[model samples]
Target: MQTITWQQFEQTDIRVGTIIEVTDFPEARKPAYKLMIDLGPLGIRKSSAQITSLYTKEELVGKQVLCVTNLGNKQIGKYISEVLVTGFEDGHQNIVLAQPASPVPNGSKLM
Candidate 1:
């Protein structure tokens, strides 16, 4: 693995956010959902997450998740994703969201 200095790691803006809304994203090449995440002081941001394999929309709402907020916007067809929702791939290749161990304030930086 490549090693990096603390300043390099600190430059990555990963923060906690809550999934406030979710909707089907048929326009995406892969099966995914368009999410509205509430990042507290950062305000709401949009994301496209390919987590339909494991999570239902109802289960995602109000769920706190980790997000990479400095990635800039990615255009998925007509949709503009404002943040990169963080997750890890399961053994089955499904994504399991990266989240806090318990409830923490939204927009809290990962230290």
Candidate 2:
């Protein structure tokens, strides 16, 4: 695998945010959710996450998740996703969200 320098890794702005809101996105080609995340100092940002296979809106609310905050906006249908909610692929290729083991303040950078 190709390797990256420490500086390059540090350049990635991965931060923690709390899921404050979730709504169904029927306009999306695939099943997805429109999320409003509270990133503390970074402010609340919107995103589209395809995690419906394993997560429900009720369970996601107030859940702290890791997000790539600097990845610029992504346009999906009428939605403009402002951040990237990060996750790993499960055995079935379903996304499993990445998060801190314990609670941390929102907008906390992954160190």
Candidate 3:
């Protein structure tokens, strides 16, 4: 693994945000959802998250999630992804979302 200094790692803006909207992304090569997250001071940012195999739209609403907000935008077909919703793979290969142990202020930075 490539090692990165703490200063380098600190450059990434990892923050908490609440998922405010979720929609089906039929254009994505993989099964995915288009999300609109409320990042407080950062405003709402859109993301194309591949968590469809594990999460339902109904279950994602108002869910606070960790996001890498400074990755810049990426275009997937016709969709523009603004942030990366953080998660990890489960034993079954399903994505399990990464979230705070308890609720903190929305847009709080991960220190």
Q: What's the CA error at residue 43 for candidate 2, in Å? A: 0.1
Q: Report the Cα RMSD per candidate.
A: 0.7, 0.7, 0.8
lDDT of 1 by residue, 18-107 (tens): 999999999999899999999999999999999999999999999999999998999999999999999999989899999999999999
Tell me the TM-score of each prediction against the true structure. 0.97, 0.97, 0.97
Candidate 3 residues lying further than 4 Å off, grouped into runs, are none
Write down the TM-score for model 1.
Answer: 0.97
Q: Which ten residues in a row have the lowest lDDT in candidate 3?
A: 88-97
Q: State the lDDT of candidate 3 residue by residue for 14-102, as single tens digits.
A: 99999999999999999999999999999999998889988999999989999999999999999999999999989887899999999
- Give the per-residue lDDT digits (tens) of candidate 2, residues 15-61: 99999999999999989999999999999999999999999999999
Sliding window of 10 residues with minimal summed lDDT for model 2: 69-78
Clash-forming residue pairs, model 1 = none
> Which pairs, if any, clash in model 2?
none
Model 1 misplacement above 4 A: none
The lDDT for every candidate, in the order shown, is 0.97, 0.96, 0.95
Higher-lDDT candidate among 2 and 3? 2
Which number leads on lDDT? 1
Error of 1 at 45 (Å): 0.3
